[model samples]
Target: MTQTVPRASATATPADALAAGIGFLRREQDRAGWWKGELATNVTMDAEDLLLRHFLGILTPQAAEESARWIRSQQRADGTWATFPGGPADLSTTVEAFVALRLAGDPADAPWLTPSAEFIRDQGGIEAARVFTRIWLALVGQWSWDDLPNLPPELVFLPSWFPLNVYDFACWARQTIVPLTVVSTLRPVRPLPFDVAELRTGKRPPKTRTPWTWDGMFQNLDTALHAYAKLPFNPIRKAALKQAAEWILARQEADGSWGGIQPPWVYSILALHLLGYPLDHPAVKAGIAGLDGFTIREETDQGWLRRLEACQSPVWDTALAMTALLDAGVSAGDEMLVRATDWLLGEEIRVPGDWTVRRPSLAPGGFAFEFANDGYPDTDDTAEVVLALRRMGKPDHLRIRGAVDRSVAWLEGMQSRDGGWGAFDADNTQVLTTKLSFCDFGAVIDPPSADVTAHVVEMLAAEGKTGTRECRRGVQWLLDHQEDDGSWFGRWGANYVYGTGAVVPALTAAGIPRSSPRVRRAVRWLAEHQNADGGWGEDLRSYRDREWAGRGDSTPSQTAWALLALLAAGERESEVVTRGVEWLCARQRPDGGWDEDKHTGTGFPGDFYLSYHLYRVVFPLSALGRYVRGGS
Candidate 1:
């Protein structure tokens, strides 16, 4: 079983003057409409996948080609890839690139390909490739026979209510996993007449007993799942698989995507092909073709920078940008704020997602998306938008205010019995699902996470939810969630630093006194956690290492987060503040941004992390601009 990590010590609260500073921030928002910048998913992983396709001479459109190239160009000389700069290189990503470049027609003897293959061999060669990577390799017969886990396309034959039912995985995983089940069962490895000398594992892997064990990480689970394929099954299972395939087809998003994510698309396309469907198959063709839209093309000095088919969430972006602008002293009716409000208004989620499961009574009209995420249902967007609008000058800015109020009402109604909020669903108490061996994940349901709940608390507090039963409940929830060391677990951000930063402002905004015992402890944690460079950063590894929970090798965006949290906690003249500001200013790139190589956000603990492109700009500008103007 997984365990929550230890928290850091909470510090003493500061004097009352801190209230004025927070008020300055809250008061500057546009009439309670929420907004936040979109976070880009793991670029390294996402990019390498695109490059692999390109390397195969698949020849994506010009834009996608450039993006894939750009991603490949960023590959460090070490022949390894990382989600963020200077972080540990991931094996799966490296292997993906090695194969992609080889497909791009680069000879294995090429200078770059040599080191890349060497690195892969050193890391266990083809044996170490992730199941997903192996599946891709199997597509082209790059790997040998009998080595892959058997996922007979016949699984299209299983029922919904069974133990390994189709819907058991999280929505994100389900989309990809469902299709893969079909593809693997068929086991169609395309003929690779060309040399794959670099990809050989040097030997076939040994078979194993007891394939089920969470102790082995995601890879071990792959081995186990493959082992289960050898077992016998009954006739009743045959009908269920058909139902699942039908369900999969029916739920395809309007944009030809499932859950607005890529993995499912790739897997689904492969699976359909294995199911006797050709390239002309409607679902297969649309699925393969839709990815082109997600590519982001950027021209670089070296040819072009290529990207993959991933989403872009602008609705969330506008909301967060508005908040940053407001905090920087832009008042009511500010041009930027108005434009942001308009953008957010256009981006609201009118149709509910699976979140409606916990909230049957609430209407489907809520959620926000960055332009990229397009139509995936989400909660943080609505919550943050509420905070943004509530801070606007006109108490009666009808349109934005109406949306905020409606969103607030919807958000309030969705709160779980636990007194906190979840991102997509509530009362996700199906803990039994997590206990299953195939479930190599943390939680299936979107339970009340620290980040989502804090966003709700922050929004409601801005809209004068202060001291109300809801406010108190939310505040108490945060207080209750705090670890003995005084920090809360940041379900969404990288580590405790994110949890701590979010809660301090929320509690303070909800009328918690500057000196409240709870408030005091959170502040002290931030003050004490500052790095020697007068900045703050927490490694993504902190998700695993409790001791280094909120520690990172100082960066601008993180420093801004720490400073913002400290300022919210009423520490104006603290030495940490001066040093944070100095670090940001000193490191500001000529393009008016900071180089944030650290992954400040989490996707799934130990599975993925995000390097938000805008976090470097907006968060620092909000903090630095405020400090420049005599912020607390």
Candidate 2:
């Protein structure tokens, strides 16, 4: 006997919702045949942009006000800015936003400023913010440079085999750290026009003793680095600075940004400037211009607002859109799909990048998340890109086959020794790197994740390599890492629901039976966690607190994620899945899309979150299409 599922009355039928979603995607497609949604993060992007302009001495009053308008709009009623929607107040984000507002000429004693300043003091003031936040304040003379940790440029000269070498850090952290070593060594301080004393409590937080621990050891190391910074004559330091500058310059992308992300982009400009590169220098000029490209400007009810994307996701979004379209019954031979396939083929990376530091002999062939991050083609994007290409039944078979072959070889070579795939470099799991006092923010190392590994396993299985040793090992790895409650942790998405969703389909594709204990447990977990409204959602807090796992208000993308797993697990006729389908149909907008203000993507797990605007449409369309087709 099948379990009964309660039905909710929906304005649109599943078929109607699918058609509307497909049409919405078609209308949103670019002339070049791709789709990209707005990648929204917290106010730090806007706050940091203002500070960068002030440091470069190019901040226009209009620009400041525009950015400030956007920043001010993000503040919560408590006068604090959380990293994500409905999350707790973040001291660092609140501090950064308050200072940026002050820089925009918001009077310190003003009604809005008073609440923010009070909140900062209550949270232990500027002294309690993260290292990166303090580093930003130090740049502007608001915080003493001496109080911060020192990162020597000499660390760049460490051999690859040595512990804590530059390559040991994640690609994102590596990019930011190299230039920061120079900035810390030069220690430039451009004083702000006004003081932020109101945001400080004037009393230092008490320190705890832990002489035998990793934190204690790294703290001692930082003390030595500080002493080294005070030296008058150090011949090796001069050579290290030269080498570090060259390292930064060599890695600059074609668009003049480093790694196509904000941290590195901003720090590289500052480091180069201190190393005597004039503002007019081509590298510096292009760097500034590239940032303007990342800037999103729009007219709102309040006023014209400006904000920045920490990174872009054109290739990632385009690949996902293609897969969604195919799942929604769009013909593979459609001109729209052919154009997308062609564009993806053109974007493939065929040359060496930083990943080669470890796999030096491995040939390069993969896709990156952004438009021009050739230096870092990730496994996640490459896996999905291959899956999309394999689905297209167009006339460009030979070309697509060659690219797919290269990507398979590249991905296999990039797998970690533990038989799993990380987004970037393989075996980049140095625990000591995260223990460093200077590395006290977001993930600093790329480690194999269940979600990424699941995609690779699914792609390989789709290619008929299910019996290969690599595929078998990846399957075992996923089995070995499931949570006690039957879910997997999603390193790149929101908590357990995302992880379980990605894994269930991949396991079934790789030949795991729906009746397998692991699959059934995951299915039960999803069904048990269903929201009262018949949809699914998981909070970003699940990354930090287990109590929140698979719990939150319903979201379109997350609900679709759950449905995809159930549909793949042979649950097409189950009441639980029927309810999920009905929930999506009832929520469909007239234009065929859904409204989702909450972030469904993860950047740094607990520290950062992302809102992929396209997710609300693409995912639901795929789910509803599969449902209407009776799980295909």
Candidate 3:
């Protein structure tokens, strides 16, 4: 699931660019004939999926209408929406808008419909929808599911330790595939529980690009996964499925959901339903109702950002914001710090999760992304937040500071000996378990990504805790990871750009010299990659496409990172520095905001991207805030 992005792939045309992107994606499809990447998990997808079901008679007309009413009510005024502030009008959003309008019974001229449709059409029409979207169509027989890569129900056979086994798949995929195996094998089109015949154009678009066959290694390896999938399952495989089901079911939280994420929830719904749970069963009903709660409402002059799903990251967000503001040179004890700190205090996660299993030696409590995500957030944010607070030049409220200490202690115990930190727990390093033929995921079991480990290192240094045995190990790990190009891979951000940006500053803070070869090489990398527009960008493709090498259109946040790296290296007058700074100034929203745009936020590099609306503002502000202060 993890990949080191290489250089850009050459594409003579936009058509070629997209063709290559999709083609590259196509090859990743499983033998199950299903293509699932990061599960898009946004409100738009949920909303539109409901609408599609309704329009196509898969759900009741009344249900469809009700959902459409809810969706229509969430739009903003600017005729466009960025999932995050100053972000872009996601094609997924546009597609959802179109389908929702159809459910609303809007005539073709419906004011919003026209603009939304235009946007959808412009973004490559139906074809532009992600492979997952197409997979949905294939399910309804609107598109051919056969066209899907074969997903034999038999992958149920592989043992966890074997290469290509189910454990190789991330936790998310593990939950989904168990059920998907049933669905694909059964391949039954449940009766439309409502009418959606009106939305389609009635034809698949003409072939637009060349087939995307790579060095053909994947093409061949794919054969093994597919072959194993076809093999008969012994009792062991059946028992594995039983274990997987129980595992998934037991993990479902009190509200009847799993993963604090939508994709898993959706699949859980499908899985249980197939397991003979009726539509009205309590678990099924709860799962269905949970979908309704996953929406957000923000009316503005610009278009509404009906985020595919509401954020489940309050704890994560609050912690990161506190840390980011502090990094921006904000004085400690400022109102922002106290407010964020207070929020973090109240939001500590008090339960155990997968991290607990991977590290039974650690304590039971862990944090979640949001106060609600009580599922995953454990060490990453907590560790970083502790670092942020420990370094603050302010007094913490007694109660809050104590909570921070508990959090930090937990992180210290969670550190891997290499000094690099994994996000949730320590010693969870069983990558071999998930690489089986049954696995189909981007999340590795416990691999330490550079971005995350670097954040931990920076946090330690900020607290003047660097050079300790553990911290030094983390530093060495970072040093070891530096690419020949000087950039390390960013695990949480885009790709190399984000990794390099973070690595350089942390190393410098640890007292790595500006002239150190590592620092100079990173500086050169940043300088060389700086865009003409003064900003920086690495496409989502960087997650899966080494050729794209994480390079792409410039955005404020990426530009800021580039600037931050160069700035840390004391590259004040570097030509790259000037252009990057200028780009930020020019792109500033008149309201002192940057576009709620620029895909700097990282999801699993390729399958999903984030519109960190705040990035447009927070980062630009950080860079600008520090820069305009008379060059420090």
* Model 2: per-residue Cα lDDT over 1-632, one tens digit each: 02223333356899888888888988998988878898999999889889989999989999899999999888899888999988898999999999999999999898887888888899899998999999999999999888888899998999989999999999999999999999999988999999998888888645734868888777778888999888999999999999999999998899889998999999999999999998999999999999999999999999999999988888988999898888888899988899999999999999899999899999989999998888999999999999999988659998999999999999989999999999999999998899888887899999999999999999999999999989999999999999988999998888799999899999999999999999999999999999878899888888899999999889889999999999989999999998899888888888888888789899888898999999999889888888887653
Off by over 4 Å in 2: 1-9, 205-208
Question: What stretches of model 3 exceed 4 Å from their correct place?
Answer: 1-48, 51-168, 178-188, 191-245, 254-257, 278-282, 297-307, 327-331, 391-401, 412-419, 424-446, 541-551, 572-579, 628-632
TM-score of 3: 0.69
lDDT of 3 at 569: 85
Highest-scoring model, lDDT: 2
Compose the digit string of candidate 3's lDDT tens values, residues 156-219: 5666546545445555555566566655544445333223333444456444233354323444
Candidate 2's C-alpha lDDT?
0.90
Residue pairs with colliding backbones in model 2 are: none
Native-structure RMSD, model 3: 11.7
Query: Which is the winner by lDDT between candidate 1 and candidate 2?
Result: 2
lDDT: the better of candidates 1 and 3: 1
In model 2, which range of ten residues has the least summed lDDT? 1-10
- RMSDs, each prediction? 7.1, 2.6, 11.7
* RMSD to native, candidate 1: 7.1
Scored by CA lDDT, what does every candidate get? 0.64, 0.90, 0.58
